[model samples]
Target chain A: MKVHVIGIGLIGGSMVLDIKSLHPDATIYGIDTNESHLAEAITLGVIDKVGTFDDLAEADFVIVSVPVDVALTLMPKVLDAIGDNTIVFEVGSTKIPICEAVANHQRRRNFIATHPIAGTEFSGPSAAIKNLFQGKTNIICEVEKTTFKLQEKALDLFRSLGMRIRYMDPKSHDKHIAYVSHLSHISSFMLGKTVINKEKDEQDIFDMAGSGFESTVRLAKSSPAMWTPIFKQNKKQVVKSLEEYISNLTLFKELLANDDFDAIFNEMQSVNKIKEILNGMKK
Target chain B: MKVHVIGIGLIGGSMVLDIKSLHPDATIYGIDTNESHLAEAITLGVIDKVGTFDDLAEADFVIVSVPVDVALTLMPKVLDAIGDNTIVFEVGSTKIPICEAVANHQRRRNFIATHPIAGTEFSGPSAAIKNLFQGKTNIICEVEKTTFKLQEKALDLFRSLGMRIRYMDPKSHDKHIAYVSHLSHISSFMLGKTVINKEKDEQDIFDMAGSGFESTVRLAKSSPAMWTPIFKQNKKQVVKSLEEYISNLTLFKELLANDDFDAIFNEMQSVNKIKEILNGMKK
Candidate 1:
């Protein structure tokens, strides 16, 4: 099998690492506008060779794993470049924009929209690791738009990566992800910014941060190059989520300021239900 | 050596799990007001025997591991009851109030103000595990107030738990921790509350939450009984930290509303330094 992968960064590079194990005979072509990332992906043995969009026609599968904005622009072009039977898919965080971008394309039936809900805070080709997608949920949005043959093939590939597939409309996927994923990144970034802004003594932050702080602020270390586009692409849903998050924080602040320890304690207890919710998610 | 451990829950129980190896000959007595906890601790073999505050006089070491409010109320009493040369210490999240509460006590020299910067989201004796403090930081505040002999013994105990000790003024410890540890719990709780409030569909939250959301909101699963008193005791510093966090979120919200991608991107990149800060803390 010949596979063409766009944007040799975390998602794409990780896919290369895991998928190559399942298809050792597969020839993978790495494509990235960032020449350095393409080279690094090769050096990391995440892909077999360097190629371009021009090579899409000969590929059995084409995966776009670039920033959402770049994916939005590249989706239509990729569909135009790929052969009739070749399957194309993207693993972008925000699905709506990209799905809408290629909705009317003549070759739309060949393209699948996916959001693999797995990643570490780290980024780049060096950050890629095998089994990154194992036991993780993969949201496949607007699957009905894709041809049955390609959808089956994509599902097989996702299964091979040990990902459980969930189908949803692009709109629902974006909105729900705004709360569960995007909002989390925003909250962590803001927390890191708030603490960094207040505690100018870096050593103090270094010394005082415990496991809780480390876990809570871990997403703040994520690449801005990737998240900025995702936030922008899903701005409407993200903004709504942020407004609610800000309102909740304000209420919590008032509870603290009022010395209403009971309310604060109850509020925390109420949210403690997230443990069960997270457990369900893991399953 | 005879040791009396107050509040045989997560911290104290974990201490028993780890420190037992280093001081196998030590006669450890569990002291908790909660009857069930005392029974469970004894049943779990976390302590050799169950004791009470009255046992303080016989203890070569008195480790108070209760909520900060309880610790503050008990620190003076514990100090009064312990004999000279008995190294008394409490591992409360907040340090200033407990330190100040016993500052002028006749036995203050025997009490060491320490906050072991370690814990899981879970609570109780059932949640306790061995080596929870391995390679974690243990902040010892107001070291000058404790006698040098007690300080060395406390350090040795903390080191035996595989902790690195950092000394600071109680005021500094409380303030810095308000941003790093306490603020993280608040942010996580508020994040969980916000998502729970908005998503209304609990199933949606469970289905959509990824690893990032789980990590960012993990502290929301923490025990309210343990956290409430810490927040109440460190109210000033916590409120200050929460205000800053809320302000940062509000500002980020506005940036999203205004499509100020550059500002948001720059803010995230700046906070990205936390990766290095956290790495240093780990080492």
Candidate 2:
């Protein structure tokens, strides 16, 4: 089997690593715009060889894992290069833009739109590790748009990687993700900014910040190179989510200002239900 | 040695457990307004016995770990009851308010204000665990107010438990903590609220939420009874932190609305320095 992977960063690199383990007989070929990343991925054993879009026709499976902005333009070109039997899946955080980008493609039936809800704050090929998708949700949007043969093959591969599959339309996927994923990143970034601005004495932050602060601001460490495009592609939903988040923070401030401890307690107690919601999300 | 712990919940309970391990020969006595907590602590073996303020004279050390509002009234009383030789430490998140609460007490010299910057989102005696303070920061405010002999005893015990101590004025402690600790809780609670409000269909959240969302909103699961008093006690600083956080979110929203992806990328990239700050905080 020939597996071709593009943009071999964390997600793509991790996918190929796991694929190597699962399908050792399959030749893993990597394609990345960054020459260094491709070389590093080979050195790190993330891929068996370097390949390109020209090599797509020979691939049994093609995984496109670039930034969403790059995926928008690359998707149509990728489809044009793949054979009828070859299956392609683009794993990105946002769905609608890429879905629309390939919506009118000649080989649209060969592509599957996936948002694997898994990752760490770190990025890069070196950051990739095996079993990343294990027990994590993989939201596949527009599954009906793909040909039955390729859809079955992709689903089988994703299931083999131990991912729980959930199908949704691109619109709902983008909107809901804006709240659950994108909004968390924005909230974390702003929280980090707020705390950093106030605590100019960096040593003070290092000395006083507890586990709660670390966990709450952990996402602020995510790569801006990858995330900026995601926020851009999902701008409308992202902006709406930010507005709601800012309003909530403003209300919390007012509750504190007015010495309304009861209201503050109630607000927190209600949100405490997230523990159960998160438990459900946990693998 | 006799150690008396007030409000036998997470912090207090955990402290007594560690002290028991470190000083096996010492007697551990628990005191709490909730009768069941005392019974539970004894059952959990968090303490050897239940004691009252009347038994304070026998204590070599007294740990007051109740809510800060409760500490306002309780600190003076705890100080009044302790003998001259008995040292007292109030472990609460805010400092200046409680420091001022017992500023002129006859036994002020016997008390130390400390905030162990460590805890989980979980609360209660059952939530307590051993080694909770190991490799964690214990911020001691107004350490000078405590008698030399008692300060030596308390600092020795904190070190024995593997705590790294940093001394700060009560005013500085509260203001700095508002950014590192208090602001994080507020941000997590608000993020939880925003997501919960928009995802009226909870299944979407459960399926779509990733590790980032879970980590960012984890503090929202914290006990309201524990946090409400901290926020109330440090209202001024907490409000200031919240305003800054809200303003950053507002500015981020404007950047998004304007399609200024470069500025957004730069903003996140700058905040990414939290990686190093947080790394320094790691044990």
Candidate 3:
């Protein structure tokens, strides 16, 4: 098996590491815009060798793990460079933009749009770890657009990495992810901003922050370079989710202002069901 | 050592577990309006026996671990019933209300205002676990108001439990905790509410939610019984924090609506400093 990974970072680097372990005979090649990252990934033994677009012709699979914005301009060119037998799949947060980017390409059937719902706040090749997708949901969008043979090959590879596959249209994928992923990043970032701004006025405020605060703001540490484009591409849904989020906050604040402890308790009680949902997600 | 704990929930139960471990000679007594909770505490070995207010007169130490609203009414009574040498402390989230609740009590010198910033999302005796306070901050407020000898007993017990004590005035503690602890809960609860409300329309949306969403919304699983009174007691500061948080969210939304990805990127980048604050908290 010949595998080429582009924009080697946490997701891409992790994917290839699993491939190496699962397919011992596979030869892994990598390309990254950051020369240092490519070098670091090589030093870290994340990839077997460095490769360029010219190497795509001989690759069995090409994993595109660049930022959503970069994926927009790079997906078509990647499709142009791949051989007829090559399968190219891009893993990004938002789907419709990437799906539409190559909807008219000559080798459209060679591409698959997927978002394996997995990651940590950290990024870069050095941050990658193996088995990140194990038991994680991998939402494959526009699977019908990809040729059956290529889809089978990609699905088999993903399955080998222990990813649970779920099929959805690109539109639903983007909208649903806005609530689950994109909106959460915004909520976390803004929470961090609000507290950081207060930290300026109160130097020792963070000393009082506990595990609850840490968990609530953990995603604020996510990579802006990767997230900015996701928010831009999924702007409509992200905006809608934020509006609903802000509205809920405002209502909660109003209940607090009115000294309506009963309403406040009910509000929190209603959302406590998230515990079960999170338990399900954990499994 | 005779120790009586009022409200044998997560905080009180966990504290007694540590107290029992550290002071083998200590006899732990628990009182709760929920009779079943007191029974469960004994079954879980979180407390040695159930006691009433009458037992408070013979207690050497009294730990109040009820909601802030309830604490406002019960604190003075506990202070009244304690022996002259007894040290009584309350571990409620809001300090101002609890501190003022017994400002003029005859046994004010026997009371120490401390908010041990430790707990999990779960509540009740079943959620109690040992060493929950280890390496965690325990904020001591209005220490000057307590008698030196009585304060020593409580401080020594806290130190034995491995808590790092920080002294702050009641006013300062309430205001600072609002931004770090209280506001984060509102943000998390509202985040859960936004996603849960969306889940009604989009049944499978949660399947797309990953660890990031789970982390950001974890505090939503917190007991409303414990939190509603916290928001009620610390209303003013919590309201102020909510306004600032909402304002930041609104601004971030506008930035996204206007396609100002640069600003959005900068926003997250700036708040990325929370990584260090959280790292500091971990220490």
Q: Which candidate ranks first by TM-score, i.e. highest?
A: 2
Q: Between prediction 2 and prediction 3, which has the larger TM-score? A: 2
The candidate that wins on DockQ is 2
Q: Listing candidates in order, what is each one's chain A TM-score?
A: 0.97, 0.98, 0.98
Give the per-residue lDDT digits (tens) of candidate 3, residues A152-192.
99999999999999999999898889998898898999988
Q: How many backbone collisions does model 2 have?
A: 0
Fnat of each prediction? 0.90, 0.97, 0.90
The Cα local distance difference test for each model comes to 0.88, 0.92, 0.90
RMSD in Å for all candidates? 1.4, 1.1, 1.3
Ranking by TM-score: 2, 3, 1
The global Cα lDDT (0 to 1) of model 3 is 0.90
lDDT string for model 1 (B51-93, tens) is: 8777788788888899888887788888888887799989989
Q: Write the per-residue lDDT of candidate 2 for residues A1-283, one digit (tens) a residue.
A: 9999998988999998999999889999999889999899999999999997888998999999998899988888899999999999989999999989988888999999998989999888898999999999999998999999889999999999999999999999999999999999998998899888888889989999999999999999999999999999999999999998988889999988999999999999999999999888874
Q: How far out, in Å, is residue B183 in model 1?
A: 0.9
